[model samples]
Target: MKEQFAVDVLICGAGAAGLMLAIDLARRGISFRLIEKAAQPFHGSRGKGIQPRTQEIFEDIGILDRIVAAGGVYPPERLYHNDGSYSDADVMERGKPTSAEPYHLPLMVPQFLTERVMRERLMELGQIPEFSCELVDFVQDADGVTAQLAGKGGEETLRVRWLVGADGGRSLVRHSLGIGFPGKTLGVRALVVDAVITGLSRDYWHRFNDGDMTRQISLCPLAGTHLFQIQGPVPLEGDIELTAEALTTLVAQRTGRDDIQVQSLSWTSLYTMNARLADHYRMDRVFLVGDAAHIHPPTGGQGLNTSVQDAYNLGWKLAAVIQGAPEALLDSYEQERRPVAASMLGLATRLLEAQKHGNMRRGREVHQLDIGYPESTLSQEQPERLDGLSAGDRAPDALIRGAAGHPSRLFNLYKGPHWTLLGYGLDRDAVPSRAGLHIHTFGPHGDVIDEQGHFYEAYEPAMGDWILVRPDGYVGAIVTHENLHALERYLLQVGLGVPGVFNG
Candidate 1:
C-alpha cells in the first residue's frame, strides 16, 4: 500500500532552531508544519548573542539586514567593586571586518526579538508556526513517519516524510524517541530576568561582584528595548521568589546600591546550567536539532547560535532528499553537525569555568568563524592542495566585477538555494553546468573579474582549480582538471548531479 503524507517535514518547536528550519524550508518551497506547545512566541530575553557565523547564515537566509537593524554590538562591561569603585573592561575581544570575514563582532539581540524577525520572515514566505500544538507521540517506519499531534481542537494524526525535534532541553519528541541525553547537571543556579530597571545607564553592561565569582550579578541592557536582562546567583539554601519585588531586593542587596531598582519584570526564571549531548541525532526518519541534540551552559553565547546553524545544516539536506535526492544526503547531516556540537559544548563548558575563576574574557573562539567539517565524508580535497582553504572549510567572501562592470560579492552570488561552483582560471565551457548549480569563472577574460585579486588571494587556486561549495556555505570539494571526473562522481554521490548526465 502506498503511504499518504500530510507534509514533507513536521517541525516540533517554534524557537530559533525550529523557526530557522521553517524559514529555510519555506524559502525552498518545501511543505512543512512548525508547531509549538506554547500559545505565543518565546518572550524572554534569553540567548541574546548572535555570533558572527550565525550572522553569515542570517545573511544567506535574507534576514541579516533586519537582524542588524534590530540588534546592536556588545557593549563594554562596567564592573563595580564592593568598595564603591568601578572599572571598565572589554566585553569580548573585538575584531575588524575583512573582505573574507565581513561580520566580525557578535550582535546583541534578545531571543524574543530574534524569534520575531524569523517569524516575520516565515510569514512573508507564507507559513506561520502552529502554536499550542504539541506532538504527543510519533511512530516512524521505513516509508515515512506517523505523528500524533495534540492541539486546541483535539488529537490529530499527521503523516510526514521526516520528523524534526527542535524542542528545547525537555524535548517531548526526543524523550518520546527514547534517545538518551546523558550528561551531568552543574551545581550552578542563577535567576535570569527581563526587567525594567531604573538608575542604570544603558551605555554599558553593568556587573556587580564582591570579588567572589559565585556572588556575581549582572544587568545588561537589552538591545532594541528599554529593558535590562538581570542575572543574579540563587542562594543554595533558600527558595527565592521570582517576582519583580524579589528581583528588586536582590539587585539592591547584591549591588549595595539604593539607586538601582528593578521597576518591573516581564519574565524571570531560575536557570540551572547543564551540559548534555544526545546519544544519537537521528533515529530512522526522526531527527534531533538544537537543544534537543545538545545543551550547553550560558557561556560564550554559543547555544542559540549553534542551534540556528544546526537547522541551517539540516534544512538544505531535508529539502534535497524530499526533491528526489538520495536519502544518503540526509545521513551527512548527523555525521557533520554532531561533531561541531560536541566541540562547541566543550568550549562553552570551559568558558563557564573561566567565568567562575573571575576570567570573563571572550575571544575569537566564541565567534565560531573557525568551525568546519574537514573530517566529514562530504569534504574532499587533494592532499597536496590542503595548505590553504581546503575542502570543508567555510567559503570566504571576496569582491568581484561582473561582466557588465558591476560590483558584487562571492557571498551575494551564493545567496540563493543552490550549489555554487567557482571555476578559478578555468574556461567557462570547462565549468560543469547543472540546473541547480550556479557557476562563475574568475580570472582574465572570465565571467567575472577578481578585480583586486581578493578571490585569488583568498582561495589561492592554481590555473585550473575548481571549488564546489555546499548549500550551507562550506567547501564541498576542490579538484583540478586532471581529477575533474572526481567532482562529477562526488556530486552524483551527494545527489547533486543528475544520473547518467555529464555537463563537462
Candidate 2:
C-alpha cells in the first residue's frame, strides 16, 4: 500500500518556472506540491540575466526587491583578439528607469540564486518544495489526476486536481502525453562552467574569439559573487569532462592567457543549442510550462524570462479555476503562452544567428518588454479607433493620489490576485462592487487622483472610460461607462464572475 496525498496542483521540477508557479499558487492560498527530482536545489549560473518585463512580474509576486538586492546590471563587454589585445564597450543596451517602467535594465543573478529567492518566498507562504521527489507516472481523468511519485524512502501516490510539467527540456510529462518537440539541434556545442578566477577584471564581460569568429569564449563575472561564468565551445571529438582541471585548461587555451587561473570550480555543463516547442501546452488536466513546453537558445536571455512569464500567465488562471471560476479558463493558458513561446524561439534563433555572424550588440529586442498578447481571446477592445492602451496590452504604472490624499501608484493598487477596474474620469463610486474585484477611479474626487494626468495619458481613455486589468497585469477589457455590462459579459466569458452591482 502506497502512502497517499492530495493537492490542488502537482508541479514537477523545482526550477525557475516551477518555483515561480509554486510561489504564485501559494500566495493565492492554493494548495500545491512542488516536487524536484534532485535532492537539493540547483546550483548553476546558466540563466543569469533577468529581463525588465520579468522584473515587473516579480514585483507583483513580492520577490522583486530580493532579486534586485541579489543582482546587478549587466556589465559592459571587453572584447579580446588573438593578438592579446582587448577593448571594452557596452555590448548589451542599457536603459534608465522611468515612471512607467521601474526596471528598465536587465538584471544579472545566477539561476540558482533566483530559485533560492523564489523558494524563500514560497516558504513564507507556508509551502516548501518537496526535493528528491520524482514523478514516475500520472493518469488523468475528467475529475483530476493521480500521479505516482518516488523518493528515496518509497513510492507514493499524489492525487492532484491538475498536473504541471515544468520538468525542463526533456519533460517526461510531455513525453508521456505524446507531445512532439520538433526542432533542429544546432551543431554548435558549448561548455559552461562557474569557477573562481583571478587576474580578470570583474568590471566587464570578457570575450575572446579568433580572427575569423569561428571559435569564441567568454568569461563573465557574476554579480554578488567572486566566481565568473566561463563559456567556450567544445570540440566534437574531445573529452567534455566538467572537472576543474579540464575547465582550467580550456580557459587558458581559449583566452591565450596563463595568468588567469581557475582556482575553484562549482558547476559546469555541456549545452547544445536546441530550439524546440511542445506541439501543445495543454492536454486535458495536464499541462506543460517553461522548458517543458519550449526549449531555445539562451541568446537574447529569453529562455528564463519566457519561462517565468509562462508561470505568471498560467498561475492566476489555475488559481481562478480551482476557486470555481471555470474549467475553460485553463484553455486560455495554452492559447496565450504557446504563441509567446514560439515568438521567443524565433527571437532567440535570430539573436543566435546574429551572434554567429559576430553581431553581439543586443538592443531592445532582447529586453522582452514589448511581448504581449494583442490577439488573445481574453482581450476585449470595443472602440474601433484605438490609439493608446487597449485590451491585451501590459498595464503600465503611473503615480497618483490615494483616497487619503497621499501619493501612490497604480501598480500598488494592482498588486494583488484580483481583477482591477479603472474608471477613467468617471464618478468614484460608479464602478461595480463584488468579490475578487477592485475598483478605482482615476480622476477628480476618486480613490486614485491622477495629479499629472498620467493615467489619462497612459490609458488614452475618453470620459467615462474603464479598463479592466486582469490579475496577471494584462488589460482584459476596455470600454466606456455606458457599456459596463459588456465588461461583465467579457468577465463571464473569461471565467470570472460579474460584479454583483454598480454603485454610484
Candidate 3:
C-alpha cells in the first residue's frame, strides 16, 4: 500500500471531521487517506459537549459505547444568574432522556476525548493519519485532485478523486484555494485553563450573567478526571499575560470552589472565536467541512459536535461518489450541511449577542429553539410522519430493539456509514433498495445489542410505523412505499443510495 499512489479520497486536518470522514469511509470499504499537520494527535480538551444527534452518529460508527465508557457524556448543565440558580436542563432540550431507548440522553465528553475516540476508531478501521505531513497545497482538475504533501523528506504529491478540507478554521486548504470565509470576530476572549482538581465543583457547567456582564464556567467529566474552563466578557484587546493565577481566581469566584486544589494544570490558553461560514462549502473539485467551512463561539458548545455531524453527512456522499453512485450525491453535501452550519452559526451569533445584551432574557430566548433538521428525501418514504417525529431537523430519541431481537434504541443503529432503516410498517421486511444501507427492523421496543448478538426486544407504537435513516442518524424518509416514485426522486437527488438493485 506504499507508493506514489492514487486514492479515492484525501482528507486534510485529521481532527474531528477528518477522522470521522475517514472512519465512515473505511466502514463502507472505501479507499482513502487522512493527513494531519501535527506531529501527533491532539490530546488537549477543547470543545466540551456532544448533542444527542451526534451521539447517534458515534454509536453508528461502533464507538459510542467506548465514548460513553470514556465518560464523554457531559452531565446536564446547571445554570445561574449572577445571583440565583435557574435550570439544570440542557438549555437545548437534550437534557432529559426518555425511558425507552438505549441512549435517551446526550453525553458531555471533552473535545479531546472525542478526538481520541474518533482517531482510535479510524485506526480500528485501518487508516492512520499521516502526521507531520501537511497539505502544502492541492491541485484540482475536471477529473481529480492532486494534493502536495510535505514532511521531513521535502515534498511529494498524491492524486485522489476528491479533496476535502477538515483542517481547521484557519484552513490552509481553504487559503490555498483562495476561498473567502465570511463572519465577524467577537473581540471577546475566552480564558481557558484545564487542571486536575482534588474537590471540583459539583455542577456540570455554569454561567454567571445578570443584567450587564457574563462569565461562563464549565466542568467536563471524563472517566475519572475533570477538565474545567472559565469564560467571561473580556475586552477585545485581551492580553495573553493573564495566565493560570488569573483564571484560577475566576473559577474560584464563580464555582465557590475555593477549597478545591488544582493538583496538576493540564493546559491553558485564551481562544477568541468568530461566528462565520465559508461563502461556499465547495469550490469545484475541492470541498470543505467542519471549522474550515464555519466557526462559531463556544456558547452552546457546538463546535466539535457540528464538525463531526458534518463528516457524517459528507462521508456517505463521498463514498457514493467513489462507488460510482452519482455526482449529484456530492452536490447535496453542501446543500444539506451548509444549512446546518448556518443554523449553528445563528445560535452562536444570537448567544454572543445575548451576552452583549447583558441579560438572561435574550440568552434564554435564543437557547430554546430545538436546533435540528428534517429527513432527506433520498432514502425513506415517510415525510409527514418523519416531520411529526423531528425527521431531518435533529433526530428524536426512542427505545426499540436491535437486529438480534433484544432491547435497543433507534439511535444505536447509527454506528456505521450506512443508512439506518427502521421498519415498522406492514412491509416490515421491505427496506430501501440501496446496497450499502444499514437497515434494522424493530418489532416494537426497537432492538438491543450486547456482546452476544443483535435482536428485537419490544415495541413503541407511538413512533412512526416505518422509517429510513441517513448516515448522520436522521430520518431519510418514511414509507409504506406510497407514491414510490417520490422515493426514486429522493434517491436521484441524494445520489449513491441505489433506489433499487438495478441502479447499483
TM-score of each: 0.97, 0.95, 0.79
After superposition on all CA atoms, how large is the RMSD of candidate 3?
Answer: 5.7
Residue pairs in candidate 1 whose N, alpha carbon or C atoms collide under 3 angstroms: none
> Candidate 1: what lDDT?
0.88
- Looking at candidate 3, the ten consecutive residues that score lowest on lDDT are 451-460
* Model 2 lDDT tens row, 319-353: 87877676787888989989999998998898878
Candidate 2 ranges beyond 4 A from true positions? 1-5, 210-214, 498-504
Ranking by TM-score: 1, 2, 3
Candidate 1 lDDT tens digits, 237-327: 5788988777777778778888887788888888788999998899989999999999988989999999999999999888878877778
Candidate 3: how many backbone clashes?
A: 53
Cα distance off (Å), candidate 3, residue 20: 0.9
lDDT of each: 0.88, 0.84, 0.65
Judged by lDDT relative to the true structure, which candidate is superior, 1 or 2? 1
Winning model by lDDT: 1
Among all candidates shown, the one with the greatest TM-score: 1
**So what's the TM-score on candidate 1?**
0.97
